[model samples]
Structure formats: structure tokens, C-alpha cells
Target: MMTYQKMICDGFELNYCIKGQGQPILVVGSSVYYPRLFSENFSQHFQLIFLDHRGFGKPTRAFKQADYTLDKIVEDIEHARQILKLDDLIIAGHSGHAFMAVAYAKAYPQHVQKMILLNTATTNSQERQQQSLSYFEAYASAKRKHQFQQDIALLEQDLKREPERRFVHMCIRMGAHSFYDYTFNATSTWDGVYPNMEIIDYLWGVAFAEQNLLQQIHHLNMPIFVGLGRYDYLVAPVSLWDAMECTPHVKKVIFEKSGHNPMLEEPEYFDEQLIAWINEG
Candidate 1:
């Protein structure tokens, strides 16, 4: 793989790696991992351009507040596109990056040839059923509530007396849960590390903003493909599948045994499916 760096937006410089040689296809990494996570086998086919989203792999100043929104990330993607001088490029992103891809397609429909959204759903769908919202709310809230109780216990026992103590415990617990959920539900084998504080803050800030991106997806005008793992708990697969069915010029595919990270769990098959979709587009 060939690795390089590019200055995309103010306060953010990206570390990206590319492999193979052909039409450019940029792969956006998941929320907590860098692009180095993509399989080498998949990179041998289409040129795979993997990017470390802002505040992830390398050091950079972060947006202090809500400025770390998905819209800002979409702007970074466009900036990267221009830097690469790419046209008719294919865009792919996993998990949260899926929202970024959709936003990119919406902002630069003419520049993108096709888009692949993996393990993600529409966040701002007006027609989205209330049941789905209740499900996600309940799930996230439950997890947070449980963690809150642990925090209380830790504090009461004086195990976490320092101000930073609570932060460290929460971060470690969140990382553990995220990693565990991804491994068991998604992959049989794994290799990677959690992102640092800069990336974590950016993630926390954008989590909700990206969740409400269905309206943007509905407005997208490019040929798009939505792929999901049947058992994905991190994202509302049903909502995404439903949105794909409703959106025009789009197709949906599901990997039954996979979960949040199909590319890692089912790399060979994922590459084949993606290649076929790219050719068809």
C-alpha cells in the first residue's frame, strides 16, 4: 500500500493510504479506527484510497463544539477530491463514514460516479417509523444509564476521586464495549487500536448530527448502494434498508452473518460485491 498526506481543511491534515492502480475509489474509515484496517486482498482490485478522518490518526486541532458535524466532514471529502483532481470517483465509507458518503453525494452529485454506504442508516427520515427511533433511543439510553450507575458506584467507593478518573473509566469502558460489540457481531479475527482523545471528542460531537442525516440522503442524486450486516446493532439496519428501498437510483445488499464491520469480517466477499456494484454502476 502507498501512504501519503494531504491538507484538506483548516485545523485538519489527513493521513491517507492508496493501493492498486485504476479509477480512484476512496474508502472512509469507521469512527474509532484508521483506514489501515482495510484488507490487503481488497486493495489489489480497484485502487483503494483509505483516509484517516480529521483528529484520528495524526495530530490536529479539533473543532471545539458542534463544528465537528458531518457537514464539515463532507466538506473535507470534497476538498480531498479536489486535491486528488478526481472525477467520476467512487466513494465508500463504513459506519459513521456512511453518513459522510451520503452527504458528499448530496453536495457534489456530479463529481461522484457511485457511492457505497456500509452498515449505516438514514438519520433524518421524516417518514421513519417511531418504533425505530424508540428502539435506538432505548438502546443508547440503556447503555448510558448502566454506565452511569457504574460511575456512581466508582465514585462512592472513592475509586474514581480525581476529575480525570471518571473520564478515563468512561473512555475505557466505552472503548471496550465498542470493540467487543464489533468483534463478536462483525468479525472472527481482528487487529486494531482505539483512537485517542482528539478523535474521541470529534466522534462524541458528531454522533447525533450524523444520526439525523436521512433528509440529506433523501436528497442525494447519485447512483448509490447500501450494504449492511444483518446483525448490526451499532446502526439501525432496518431503517437503512427501508431508506434504500425508498430512495431512487439506489440498491441494497445484506450480508446475513455479518454485523457492523462486514469489510473486516467478510473481506473477500465484501470486495467481490463491491466490485460487481462498481462495474454495474
Candidate 2:
């Protein structure tokens, strides 16, 4: 059985779920999207701890723009770890959350035995942004030619009217194009978790304006696993390549048949790779 619980960390009520047994692996990301996805297969091999960041899941209060910095997020993770009395943790993060995981491991390296970064982008380079935009444009054009133009039109209109819903709508529309294989249903992969737009707006907007972590990550000396999807145009596989060049102790895995979401696109392969990496030590 899974245990759902909450803890007061630095005056904030952080929510987390714990399951399985054996080595502890703390997954810091959007729990609503990845909770069951990680637990279903990982529980048998490791104790999985899924925690929601501020303004996500069951946070005590809504987030303010000033409180959305990467340092603040890392502090929250550390506080949670101390409160839970966890030691020798293996931390993992995906997409935006990967930034937090990296920062946390850097600040508290003694606590983390290993680190996993999945489909993570370290910088908002113009070339990467253009690549993503181009992929979306091509995808839309192809879908429009297939009689799906009406759906595209409606999505654009929805974004224009309710700009705050951009993240939600973008995820829905892009999921279709982001997957390398069409056999997997994207709908089932969605966990129906509403993203904190405030958090998204501030971090991706102001926080990323003058910040890049490609160089800072070189400080990580622990066994680091970097997983990327070959078709992940949103973040681009080059980000992982760039990271691999900087970190001396690093392992890279590229999912040929997946996109930004390898776990959903190829669950069996993802599970096998993750378990093998964990057991490598």
C-alpha cells in the first residue's frame, strides 16, 4: 500500500507519497504527472518517494513569484529530507524539476548517492527554442493536412483568450507530436495534475532570463545518469550531450523510440534501464 503524507518544512506544508522498500529514491518533480508512473514499476526494486514542489500538489499555500527560485526549491527538498530522517538518497528529476535536483545535489552532495536527470534542458538557447518551434510548426502543418486543422484552430483560440492556460494546452497539443511512436496513447499518460502557472511563469520567465547551469553541474562528482529522448525537440538531446561533456562521472542513455517522455513511450525499456543503472553500483 502507498502512504500519502505531509510535512511542515521551513514553515511550508509540503506533501509527499512513499511506497515500496529497499534503497530510498526521492523523485522531485511534478508528482501529479509522475507519481503512479514511477511507482508502478519502481516500487518492486526501490523505495520511491514522490514530493510536490511549492505551488504544486498539496502545498499549504499558493506560490509567489519571489518564492519560485531554484535555491528555494532545493531548500525545500533538503528540509523534507531532514524531517523524514532519510540518508543516502538517490535523487531524480525530469524536465524543469531536474534543475532543482541538480542544485540540491550540489548543495548537499553528502546526502545523495546518485543522481538522475531525465529529458532536462540546461539553457534556453535561441537555437534550441527555434528547433522546438520549428518542430511544432511542422507537426501542426502535417496534422492540419490530415483534417485536424479545426483542432489546431481551437487550441490557438483557447490560448489567446486564456493565456494562463498556455502550459496546460501546450502539454496537451504537444504530447501528440512529442511522442516518437504513435502506438502509445498519450491520454492515458496524463495524470490530470494542474500545473502551478505562477511557478511556471516566474521560473521559465524571469529566473531563466540570465541563468544557465551547464557549467555549475560540473561540480557533481557522484554517479550521474542522464537520460534523453532522441526526438525530444522541446529540450533537445544536445543538452544532454553538453552535460556529458562537462561531468566526468556521467552515463548517458538516449531513447531512440521516444520523445520528451520516454517513461510513457517505452515503459518496459525505461524500467529496465533505470533498474540496471541503480544496481550498477
Question: Cα lDDT for residue 178, model 2?
Answer: 59
TM-score of each: 0.70, 0.84
Best by TM-score: 2
Best candidate per lDDT, number?
A: 2
lDDT of 2 by residue, 1-281 (tens): 68888877544566788888889989896555666566377688888888888746444555465676877888889988987799889999887777778889989999999999888777655655677666556554454333334434567876788676577666656554556653234545554655667777666655544446566567678888888887676776444466466456887888987777887777889889989998999
Query: Where does candidate 1 stray beyond 4 Å?
Result: 6-8, 30-37, 57-63, 124-211, 237-240, 246-248
- In order of listing, the candidates' clash counts read 2, 0
Tens-place lDDT digits, model 1, residues 1-281: 57566564767666667677777888875223434446776667678777766635444554554545666777778877888788899998776677667767877889988888877655534334344445545554455446434544544443335332333344333321333233232122213333445445555444534356556666677777788776554455355566457667777878765655677667778778877877874
Clashing pairs in 1: 123-214, 124-214
Q: Candidate 2: where is the Cα deviation over 4 Å?
A: 10-12, 57-63, 125-127, 135-152, 156-165, 182-192, 209-211, 239-247
